[model samples]
Target: MNTKIAIIGAGPAGLMLSHLLAQKGIDSVILERRSQKDIEETVRAGVLEQGTIELMRSVGLEERMNQIGYKHEGINIQFNQERHRIDFPSLTNQEVMVYPQHEVIKDLLNARQKEGASIYFEVEEVELFDIESKTPSVEFTQYGERYSIHCDYIAGCDGFHGPSRKAIPSEQLKEYEHTYDHGWLGILAETAPASEELVYTHHPNGFALLSTRTPTLQRFYLQVDRTDHIDNWSDERIWEELRTRVDLGNGPELQEGRITSKNIVAMKSYVCETMHYGSLFLAGDAAHIVPPTGAKGMNLAMSDVQVLAQGLIEYYQDNREELLNSYEAIALRRVWKAQRFSAFMTKLLHPEQGASPYELRLQESELDYLVSSKAAQQSLAENYTGLPIEWEKGKKDTILS
Candidate 1:
């Protein structure tokens, strides 16, 4: 089969890229190793940045989100048993939607289906070929049927472990990585949210975040050992850690109910330089990763595709290569910004194990300053709500390089 672009993976980045390209009469096919049910059911934390929400609205995919998603204009950063609210709108004229990532996936999937877009799920042995050439392609097997797609470009959205990133020669891939000692043990409970807005807590014990998935379901996280297993954290132990770290005295106790799901997400920040090789362009987790602290993962992924879609659109419609040429530099600027914010937020909330008393005091002072200073709060609010994108649609000038 011949197409303009061959997209790897069916995650947010891949699906969104396909959708955007379709809007411009550009044809692309998506190859996903997982089934549609699998991708739709994998629950993940979602904190939609303002730009993400706008992008969804622009694409006509925000209808379901508007009908069901919760909107939060503020988040509480708690310390010393006190919760301080950072009003995003008041600080930065922005707000975030507390929609789950899976829900967004469902929306994107549905939209693509309605548009008759081709997305192949449950494909095996996906591989790329001749990515450096003008004529690139992808080969994969679906249910014992071998298929090859000849396309002009390949988008490596297959995620961190997917084959796309590894397709680049190791000698050409420069990686920067920082692995933290802490991880987040998260659970989804069938209970009402304890707080109306998200709560991020820092305590001597560790860090905990309280977020709402739905009115009837609550999501909570507690900092734990990076190597800790789900077997070590029973339902009771999970609740105890959350209460110990996040409870506010003289306030409503955290609502509790049957725990439905549990996951342990390791803390790490990683960035792959250039984010592309030849005709292969990487977006989302295939390119970089951030700890979930700043809620930048999904937003960054979507942003990467937005830039990518713009580049591809220009190449197809206007015969322009400037945007496509500068895609890496453009995506990296926002990726690194997110890395900085996510790292800072992670470090600020979690006390390092075996940190010196002086170091602990300094962290406390940092929090103290953050809470007391408007400039600091605004900066945090802006980053959390997503700083503005530098790329503009249909702008031919390449300021990125």
Candidate 2:
């Protein structure tokens, strides 16, 4: 097979990149290891940064999301039995969309199908060769059949554990990482959300978050030991912990139902110093990962591909190399900022076990400042809704023009 670009994953980044490139009349093929049904049903992040929503709308992909997604104007922060709301619209002139990540994937996949985009699913033993060469190719198998895709560029959107990043020579890439001692035990339930807006609660027991997927489905998270197992937590025990941690005295009691799913995810912050290696460009989780506290994982991936798609479009249209050459540096600026925010949120909410009295008091004080100080709330709101995409001056106009 031959194409202009070979996208290595079918997740949001790769799919969105393919969609964007298609809009510009550029042709590309997507190679995914997971089955189509698997990707569509896998539940993930639920928050859509304002910029992400705008990008989806620009590409005619927001019709379903706009109809089903919940628009949240603010989030509540609770500490020491007190609850305060940080108004996102008042602080940043924007609001977040509470739509699951899988739904976005389904929308992108539907768009790709309508455009007749080529995507190979359930691929096995995928490999990249001659990445530094002008013409790189991806080789993989599907049900014992071997095939190779020769392309001008390859996008490693596979993920943190995928082969794309590992293909980059270890000597050329520098990785920075930090792992938390705790993790979040997340559960999805069939009940209405207790609060109209998402709530982040800090309790002596642990950190708990109250979020929603729909009017009838609620998602909740509780801080737990890193080694905790799902089998150890019964539905009753899970709800008990959540109820105790999120008690705000005056709010409605949590409405509980059968837990549909449960998983424990370790919190970590990781980023590769470079996002590109020769003709192979890394985007999304393949390049970096942020702790979920700031709700940046999916948004950052979308941001990376938006910049990448623009760079690729410029290269193919104007024969310009400046955008492509600067892709790594430009994307890294935003990537590091998100890592900082995610890390900050993780620390502010989840103190280490056996936290000293002073540490607990400091956490309370920080929450107090965030609730009382407009400037602090503004900072949180801005990062939460996402910083604007910094395209090269007039280049943004050129791309859209």
- The lDDT values for all models are 0.90, 0.90
Instruction: Please report how far candidate 2 places residue 25 from its true position, in Å.
Output: 1.1
Distance from true position, residue 263, model 1, in Å? 2.2
Kindly report which residue pairs in candidate 1 clash with one another.
none
Clashing pairs in 2: none
> How well is each residue in 264-347 modelled by candidate 2, as lDDT tens digits?
988888999768899999999999988889999899888888888988899999999888888898788888889989988889
Give TM-scores for every candidate, taking all chains together and pairing residue i with residue i.
0.97, 0.97
lDDT against true structure, model 2: 0.90
